[model samples]
Target chain A: MSRSVKKDTLLKVAESLFYEHGFRGVGLKQIINEANVATMTLYNHFSSKENLIEEVLKQREERYWSYLDAHVEMESDSPFILAAEAHGRFLKEESYKGCMFLRAIEDYGEMDNNIEKIARGHKQKLLEYFQQLAHRKGKNNEKDLANQFTLLLEGTTSMTPLIGAEKATEYSIAMARTLVQHTS
Target chain B: MSRSVKKDTLLKVAESLFYEHGFRGVGLKQIINEANVATMTLYNHFSSKENLIEEVLKQREERYWSYLDAHVEMESDSPFILAAEAHGRFLKEESYKGCMFLRAIEDYGEMDNNIEKIARGHKQKLLEYFQQLAHRKGKNNEKDLANQFTLLLEGTTSMTPLIGAEKATEYSIAMARTLVQHTS
Candidate 1:
């Protein structure tokens, strides 16, 4: 296999493992073994475990944004509703283990500044996306609305593990609709 | 130290360590060393690390309830607003590492059934607490209201690390007030 293909394979295996069992719960050996790559190949691609995790998070964030962007392009609902449905669909179809970015912060926040920065940046970017959506919608107090919208989405993600994703999403979207109507 | 005092010390030290470093991050040796207790004493009281974590969660749940109850007893606001303020205060004053019970599930959910059960049960009970408050307030659709309220609180907790506890709390309470008024 080409080096890029091998690297992609390693990231795919590592992301799944980290999502199922947290970043700390799995190790480099397990990632390599699961990826069916030699130890040297793993090191050659990522340099270090921290570097590998950082790569996985970066890739995951890209996929998440692309996923949301796709939904935004096709949907006709108001922005908040569109965003809520998009996020809820991601939760249902993707992994229900919770937000991987937040999980990364939980796993490595105290120990690794780099991981925390990346994770926090991912969330900050999402917040900005919401702000932009609100602006396009021409809503008053767009920042507060975006913040509340983000909270509901975050709440949906956090509650997914306890309440099933379907119910969590339902409640979140319902509240999102309520908030939008009430604010308008 | 007396046997019971040693047990309390062990639980206290374990809880703090687990909150700061996560359950999987810290080990039994570190817990015992921090508590200034012998290894044998820890094993004798809790029988295992899992049991020790279980006890810590139980005690934490009790303390959390007592804190909320104290606020409930003293406050005169509407149920949702009062609950939001009380939960926000807990997030601000307590460790902002996020909800410890949810963190417990995140840390040990896949590996240990007992831990997951206790952690999930803690969340369920909180939901029911919201339900009861809504019912007492003579609200229609009490169940739905409670679920939304829980989501906002969970959102506040999840967002605390990113947004800071104060801002997260302020946003949560503001949204909660909007929700209550809108629903009423």
Candidate 2:
């Protein structure tokens, strides 16, 4: 396989492992073992494990943003519904492991700088997205709506395991109804 | 110092380190160095690193439950306010590093059994607390309300860094006013 092909393969496996485990928990050996790549091959695609870790998070950021874009299409009248649908769609994804961003932040205690930066950046975009949605929805001081709604989304994802509710997005739907502008 | 003193000292130092850096990031050596004790001192008090980890989580659970008790007493009127206030108090503590249960869960990728128990137990208690509060308030469905409010608390904590507002408790307060019953 081409290096790029192999690299992407490594990243996919790594993302699942890293997400399921965490940054520090999964090491080079495990990544290589899982990827079925030689140790040096793993190093060749990424300079170090840290870089590879960055790639995993970066991959998620791209996918997360893309998911947000495709699924959460908000028109002027339906920003709230857009946000709700976006969260709902996310919940329904085949492999749900709570919020990737929250998991990353919570897991890595002293993570590589690269991983931390990517996590922070992903979170910022979500916050900004919410802000825009609030503005689009004509919320007064939309920042309030944005911040509050962000908590609802974050809360639902983070609390899923604790509540043992298979479909957390349902709660997000109720919360979305509560948050949006109720103009019919 | 006595072994009890050494044990408490180790727990104190380790707790702060784990909170700031993460359980995996801070090794036994670091804890021993910071505690100014020998490796034997650590094992003498707690069976293993994992054991020590559980103890640290245990201490946090105590503080968390105590905090909940005081807040529930003060803001029993509204479930939302009570939940928010508890979280707010959590953020206000001297060594705030978001939720300890969350921190552990994040680090515990595959689960080592013991720590999982700690995380699971705390989460159950948290849900039960919410359920009882919701039941007392006579929400639509006590189970659903309890589950929903637990998500609120969890989600808000996860979003703390993204919001960048040091006083995240304020956001919880605003959310509480909306979600809780009108007791106060």
Q: What is the C-alpha RMSD of each candidate to the true structure, in Å?
A: 2.4, 3.1
Minimal lDDT window, size 10, model 1 chain B: B73-82
Off by over 4 Å in 1: A1-3, A73-77, B1-3, B73-77
Measured against the native two-chain assembly using Cα atoms, what DockQ does each of the candidate structures obtain, in the order listed?
0.71, 0.53
Candidate 2 lDDT tens digits, B26-115: 799999999999999889889998899999999988987787777675335665576577766676664344566766776673455788
For this target, which candidate reaches the highest lDDT against the unseen true structure?
1
As a TM-score, model 1 comes out at 0.92
Candidate 2 stretches with Cα past 4 Å from truth are A1-3, A94-96, A106-112, A164-166, A181-184, B1-3, B94-96, B109-112, B164-167, B181-184
Could you tell me every candidate's TM-score relative to the true structure?
A: 0.92, 0.90
Per-residue lDDT of candidate 2, residues A95-133 (tens digit): 344666655565553455666667777778877788887
Report lDDT (Cα) of residue B91, candidate 2: 64
Clashing residue pairs in candidate 2 are: A154-B155, A155-B155, B80-B180
lDDT, residue B67, model 1: 69
